[model samples]
Target: MNRSVVKRVVIGKPLKTRELGDQKINKLKALAILSSDALSSVAYGTEQILIVLAGIGFLAYWYSIPIAVGILVLLTALILSYRQIIYAYPKGGGAYIVSKKNLGENAGLIAGGSLLVDYILTVAVSISAGTDAITSAFPGLHGYNVPIACLLVLFITILNLRGITESASVLAYPVYLFVLALIILLGKGLWDVLNGQVPESLHTPIGTAVPGISLFLLLKAFSSGCSALTGVEAISNAVPSFKEPSAKNAVRTLTMMGIILAVLFSGITFLAFWYGISPKAEETVVSQIASTVFGRNFFYYFIQVTTALILVLAANTGFAAFPLLAVNLATDKYMPRIFTIRGDRLGYSNGIVTLGAASILLIILFEGHTEMLIPLYAVGVFIPFTLSQSGMIRKWAKEKPSGWQLKLSVNLVGALITFTVLIILFTTKFPQVWPVFVFLPIIVIIFHKINAHYNDVANQLRIEGAYRREKLKGNIVILPVAGITKVVENSLAYAETVGDTVIAVYVAFDRESEKKMEEKWNAYRPDIRLVTLHSQYRSLIRPLRRFIDVIEEKGEEHRNSVTVIVPQFITKKSWHNILHNQSSLLLKAHLLYRRNVIVTTVPYHLKK
Candidate 1:
């Protein structure tokens, strides 16, 4: 089997165009596929907030309560706003789509560029955080963590290449298992909290302050907790990926995801407060709380295992959305044409591999350190969040259909809150996140270049008025032959059908060879004129190029074009191809760029 066959076997068979509709997912799988990023963020969201609040003494827990509450409030508003977006554009109106429709092309492009960058960062940060969880559980394996993260990326990449349904099937169990473990942990812990079995240290206020619990610090802590809301919009962006009644299924899934995320976020925040768990360099806050609730037993390890599974698999969200978003960008001519091509499994195969490769680079560059990478994650996501919600407000104002006031109020609140978060994330993390700024301009410029190229191509190929099918105007076939072998005879025979006139050209290096060729032509009488040229420089390409250029100079006179037929000798054994000279291959390469020259390769296969 060849490379393509092997690829199909590895990635799954090529799905037909109509088979795409069959690939739409049910709600269970859609939740697992699209909600992984948001759900998994629960594993680290509280930890991010605690990192900032650690400075304010044991009051870190005190500060965390309000931040978690704020995040929940924002989560509700964003979900309500996005539900409107899902219904408004049931065919998946992501930020780029919404902004482009309501705002303008530049706004749309900016949103697209931001979302693209965010998708890449999502994979990298999720994998890195997941790997950190593993090392926190077993400190001895810490040195090899980056390589482990890269391998995990490759694993998820293959799963995604198998198509969304297959990936959802593989991932659904772990995501559901994680939710089960989390709720159980939360239920038991909450039951203990209410029953007064909680540790006394939680309420005992140790007034040790790490100095600055200022307003800036509180805002930063709130912004940090907002990371949990990162992947919430993915559901609204990918509404069409659901089964029939797609909008209803999608909105339901989005609501379910928000509820689950809110429950987990608040549960963990409450647990962290009761348990007085602070961020540890070696262990995560979730791991710490799990130990407090379950204590180094089978259930504790179960929580840890499932957390790692969901976190690493969180890249699945990027896998699902990136390809879909890439196809959208390609359709709009903002990305390369290749992104619009489907793979064997009918997933956005190219986009899958692209996200994987980019994440791997990030994992290596940052050494798989989760804390270092987390700061860069929020800005890209929030830009789209702000723009998309603001666009919805604009759209509602202009359209003002039924219930526009309610919709406008929800989106306005979401827009203001997200814009504030975006600014806070930028001002606080700009030192570490300068890369995001640098990367955005490059991405936006690339979008412009792609749009420009597509426009130029469209203008060149546009057929206005009526397309006149002109007859083949004045054609000539030129056969470049080495000797009078079977290959030459066959090439000459095929060249006869090329046009009205055929010329068999030969390059003679010496007088003896020229005389021998003329004598053979005379004896055989192939009934074709032979134009022989002398070669001073043993380079075969130079002579063929000169001949084609000479023909090109005969514009509109001796026929319009020259078609060069190059015969390729295919060996029975692939290894034997190196045994023959590649003169005709080189000849075709020389003639290919000439203005009215056409090059055709005719394979002449040898039978043993």
Candidate 2:
């Protein structure tokens, strides 16, 4: 009985007009995309401050307000600086392009590497934050954080796989509702405070003393709260994803995001201070403010639902930006080529899978604890922040500015401010954060070195001018054959085409089988000469090597142009077929290493 394997070929269809067409996202949708990260910050950014403050006690809740305000100032400066990025380089490379064009490839690689790590952390942090919020609503979910987190990651992956516009459209309304609910809650809290009806905090019974406010503590808190601004840079990377007048739309989106973040952050901080919202005593400042203003009734539940929805949607920011940034990095040859190829749906499939898996792992490692992840978070974000801003400074320095001298000065100040913030972040948080920061740069540097090595090896192996100019006038053709099959016939035919002095060579494992094969070859092709080499190891490679050495010693000039033909059978089923046991492919690979030895394969296809 004979078995035949069939290979299936797939044909690809072009994207339909709607799929390939640009997304006509209005101001709201664009705002939703840009603010997806910032709006979601309300869910955990305050919690992160509280977590840090909790270490000191409930009295430190007052510090959250000033910290939030500090974050707002930095966010405003960042937004203005990025507006320049949108105007100057509208392409999606964002920090990578800015760094590469100004500082050089090493700076670009550093920025790209930092941003890549930040995107992965964004996914992990968002998912962990969402998991905590969900567990708060359902206490039974305490131990199931990892499973639920992975499920959330899987769900987000599916949404992204559907396409970017589709995912944004799905999340738009819920994100909007989250913003409205937050505003309403903050407004009501302020109204109560204005009327001298400030409600007592539910968690005040925890009765904790605030830590003494030092410059270092304040800077640490400010850097932690700056987690709110982590995703603002995504807009610069996603400029091309916008519709017509891409740069204008990106700048508009950036402005809207900045305004929204500032208002929500400032209002929340005010309400937190006015009502004494404390995570040291209470888990979430938003929930505490919600319960205080709206009571523990339907409004509180509504706020909880919307808050959770927004946190989940915050992960959408990473979903949208990671793939785009990865594509840019891949294009620059700093990353694997797979990231550069888009899926059938025009999404970065590799980036999506990679981002989701990494985020889920981080969530599990942190036990879905946003606090534990926060220290690690700011390190990645600020590395890119300082590098990209430095790139912008270099860019302005190089350009001959005419009308925008003030703008250039603003960029310089912006770079200085961000650089200072980065220094503070590294110094204050590095004890807890440095381990993560150290590993990422090490991995990136290792990958860069590996790629460089691969390119160097490939360059050496490539045929050069001198090698190609040499003629193979007197080389002998050695055709290795086995049995009286089509593989042997094909090898013989090809060898004849190369030159007239062609000999069929074979290795005999034993004398009996050797005699049978030699008789068969003579019957099949009497015109062809046959030579057999005896092998003690039962391996073809050793015998072939010995045979070639013998031929070379006879005449060096003849050896310089020799061609080796090996008849190889092409099996339809890749797994089941074994032609030379363990040595066939290895033999061909070894032969390829030698100079002046040309190896040719004669494939024999089996009919069904």
Maximum-TM-score candidate: 1
Looking at model 2, the pairs that clash are none
RMSD of each: 14.0, 14.5
lDDT of 1 by residue, 345-401 (tens): 767787889889988998888788756656667877888889999999999999999
Error of 1 at 96 (Å): 0.7
Q: After superposition, how far is residue 253 of candidate 1 from its true place, in Å?
A: 0.5
Q: Which residue ranges in model 2 land beyond 4 Å of their true spot? A: 1-19, 23-27, 50-63, 199-211, 457-608
TM-score for candidate 2, residues paired by index:
0.71
CA shift of 234, model 1, Å: 1.1
Q: Residue 224 deviation, candidate 2, in Å?
A: 1.8
Candidate 1 at 275: error in angstroms?
1.9
lDDT minimum window of 10 residues, candidate 1: 464-473
Off by over 4 Å in 1: 199-201, 204-212, 465-608
Model 2: per-residue Cα lDDT over 43-89, one tens digit each: 66776676676666666677776678677778877888889988899
